[model samples]
Target: MSRRRHENFRELLSKREGFTVSQVSFQNEVLEAHNYYRDLHCAPPLQLDNKLSRSAQIFAEELASKNQFYHSNTKGVGENLYMASGSNVDSLTGKLSSNQQISSSFSYANIAGDAPVTDWYNEIEQYDFDYPGFSGATGHFTQVVWKNSKNLGVGIAYTSEGDSVYVVAQYTPPGNYQDQFPDNVFPEGQC
Candidate 1:
């Protein structure tokens, strides 16, 4: 492991909860063991909507009228091996088709459809999110390719009735927001 790279990761790990840095360096290989983790993709960004109405004028009105609480979170793993395995992999060329991760939005409502979508999660659907326990957490996240190519990805997920909502807008800086390293991620492919 390169000494510079190893030190860089060790410093990053120090910021996580319960991380303790050892004043003594060469004595232990524990810090060196974490080198490989540097290659893993960084976690997706979490942007909280201060107002639910920002999703879209019509969609927002539908949400407020129902007296339901709706929350949306998106995550895009630049290169998803699990999802890509299903199709479109040109092994001959190093350029593999990147895939998006699963992102879900759930609402707190007695009447599922009443959350305004009225039949979204139940009817006009693309993929059903079924996992035993976490019922409310069901939605689709976007996919971002790490490659240096111009590509546009559209992710529209609401449910069989209305499981998720996507709202696009320029982010107004929040007072408490901690911008991740290098803006969105850790120096992109370098990290």
Candidate 2:
């Protein structure tokens, strides 16, 4: 048994025939030992196991945005209201918001493509509200009703962490939700 063990050891050394095993070779020896030991006892390999082996360094970053546009009482007639969000979101390496103003709601649906998130003010918008009549209602506030509505929308984006990338799915809505437009005809919501 001792002779057989000696022969096995010699066989491993002979397998590297004509190769120089210098002090630097110690690193390779340790790695070889670890690989062989791990093959028998380690956990299952991960998806990125060998993919990053050749790269000197790997890095990743994640970014997100919760862009919103909201407004109230922009006009006197019908008390038009507008709200929208996340118009033309795009891929990038950092966080950002639409260049339009949250207080600017009347411009919904008017903005052209390639505009900043802020430019969302150009879009056409509408809202629903109930008003009360008052005898002393000299100022507009006397008959005004203050209210806020919740909107929801859904979108997709790519996120990264460490050396991994993930696809993120989300839902969102316009800033103000309106359903009282009896004249508004569409299969669902238009656009």
Q: Which candidate is the best by TM-score?
A: 1
For candidate 1, what's the RMSD?
Answer: 21.8
Tens digits of per-residue lDDT for model 1, 46-77 = 23222311222223223333434343232221
Query: How well does candidate 1 score on lDDT at residue 74?
Result: 24
**What TM-score goes with each of the models?**
0.17, 0.13
lDDT of 2 at 34: 24
